[model samples]
Target: MTEPKNLEVCGSVMDGIAEKGSALESPSKKQPTEYTVYPVRWVVLFIFVLYSASNSLQWIQYSIIQDAVVKYYGVSSIVVYWTSMVYMITYIPLIFPASWLLDKAGLRVTTIIGAFGTCAGSWLKVFSVPQDMFWLGFTGQTVVAIAQVFILNVPPRLAAVWFGADQVSSACSVGVFGNQLGVAVGFFLPPMLVRAQGTIEEIGADFQLMFYIVAAFTSVLFVLILLFFKAAPPTPPSAAADLGSNLDSNFLQSIKKLLTNRNYVLLLISYGLNVGVFYAISTLLNQLVLTYYPGANEDAGRIGLVIVVAGMTGSVVCGLILDKTHRFKETTLAVYAASVVGMIIFTFTLDCGIIAVVYLSSILLGFFMTGYLPVGFEFASEVTYPEPEGTTSGILNAVVQIFGIVLTLTYEWMLSNISDRWSNLTLCAILALGTVITACIRSDLRRQAAQNKG
Candidate 1:
């Protein structure tokens, strides 16, 4: 064959080999079937939805129990912030290691370990936890973060493989929707639970009740993962290495390879800025409401509920467009644009009008913010040759978190030291960072396409 034809033939053969290998390594015999009627896939998705809910429920408690944790622990709001910040910081470094471990350990063990750790940490919160409880919570959050990586990162790739390109975005969207719904429920449920409790023991019991419920639900997911979820069919010992051939690029090698690729680096920068901008706002919604209404913690929580609800709604819309159009680049751009404008409006106007702005801005931000995650994952999966799905995800997610921490801390500090008059400048600076990175990424992708065509 000619060079172009030869390359095409080689590519075809590689595709065939990958597909067969994927089938053999898949744990589920039923996989390699099809998304349309795959019983196993649905079961997996359902179980993961519950698991996601359990994971997300903790965020609600973070907002709701902020006061209680502050009083009980004799700490400041920043300390409670560290309670979360620690988890976020720990998760970044662990991403690659966790991904590597997932490759070695398989999804089952990693997920189970995460679930159990989360359950233990959550249940410990029911009573008077020791000073060491911070460590316990930290450990649990680490495990939970690991679990979330698998839960968030793995299924869509599997779905893409099983369902073909046509359905990947939709499948990813649905799974993500499940996660956001969990967030919505978490935001809405806690205040009602707190209100229902009559006394100190009753309040303690209520938290315990929430803890056990989450644990039980996650345990069920653990069972499902053990019983049905498979990376691929069984491979012989000799072929096992080949099973991860696409992922064969080790963590360090993958980082080197990705960094060398201009598009990948641009993507990293863009995703990191996106995370920094969105998380800075999401983490501070409680404070924002209190800032405005004064003693409106409950309202802040409710607004959180509204924000998540709008985000969930926006996710559905964005997912449909992205999946149907396959316009990954444009979709991200649109979301970022909406976010920048929203931040500007909210920062400048700071009135009852700003409440509506906050509501709309938060919802759009959540929608666009989370909307990028699956797409970004899909892009990484497409660009990277093979099995390092977890590793690539780890790298991307870690960068986002690292930048996110800096942005979050700086924003919090700015709010503390400066006036609300400064919100616009801080937000605009972050948004400008995002827009520039995204623009560079878009330019690089265009260059790559041109080079390939030439």
Candidate 2:
């Protein structure tokens, strides 16, 4: 037999997946002699993209609710932190399991479940009781976290299985684009809703109202999934559409292999740290400005929207650049460095001019921050070789969520006790650390590619 360059790519993994219907073989594999790369399934892609949209509401809405919850509910910063942190906390632990579920159940099933979780969480936000609202928000975020976990893992995984090697980068790019679009819509939607109804407090009787709005939109997206979502065609040249195996030895085995991969392990650390910094900044963002500038509470909502919108724009542009160049590592490192620069400037100069410092730093930070995810996803997908596409992506996604947990905890502590500048400074330091880690692993990644080619 030909030497298996990538052990994960063996024909056997496909067999194991065959037993699991969700791991259906590629339709192209059915016609190897006629194998030409098929065009991407744009319709199903759109539906999945829509399904993925709910996550943006889960993540970005934190900024919107941060001030609202703090003011109206009399909730402490710590509790408010939990509202957002709970999602990452629940999500990090369950990512491996969620990945397993997706492989066993497939993207369509996984995405719908995820969407419902997000929608449920949003609906729960409608209650008037502040304390109850906190828990409800937590529960809601947790559900959305699960939804995000699936959406994050599945799209790139599907792209790998469905698209040709030449097109994989582009497919990955499109998925990231969808993710950004969701974020943009999520951020923009809140302000519009607020405008339609005067006074932030009266806007639908609290945060729950906003949740309802988001939930309704997500339900619509879920229906879109039902209208058009298909698993990739099954394996073997001429076998009936076999669902992949219910038992996924590949999931665990793939995780083990990935954990052992030095480059991948480093990427996980760097990616996690980078992600941690972003979330850390996002979760405490309103408080950060309030601490340094003071009396900026009213404008916090507007500022939050600006950061998210800028981040969304950055993510899309970065995705396009990555798609064209395939210079994944360099692009990621540059973004990390840019974040560090932005954070440093913003943290030190905040007192000088609040609006100018905040706006400039946020735009820079948002630009770099949003791109980290897709870069990490692309790198993980490329490194995972022949593992079930989504499985590796899920593992990588899960690892980053772990960092998110640590960062979120740190954020809670900082907001409770430290000055905003200190917190921002700490985040800056973390991003700087990530940049160093990325530097260490850069050469190794290049070496691995050369070895693989050889």
Q: Write the per-residue lDDT of candidate 2 for residues 332-408, one digit (tens) a residue.
A: 77877887887787677666765866677667766777756666776665555545556767766677767887887
Clashes of each: 10, 16
Report every candidate's CA lDDT. Answer: 0.56, 0.61
Give the TM-score (vs. native) of candidate 2: 0.80
RMSDs, each prediction? 6.9, 6.3
lDDT of 1 by residue, 65-142 (tens): 566555444557776666456546767766666776655665556656666655665555543345335555545544
Index of the highest-TM-score prediction: 2
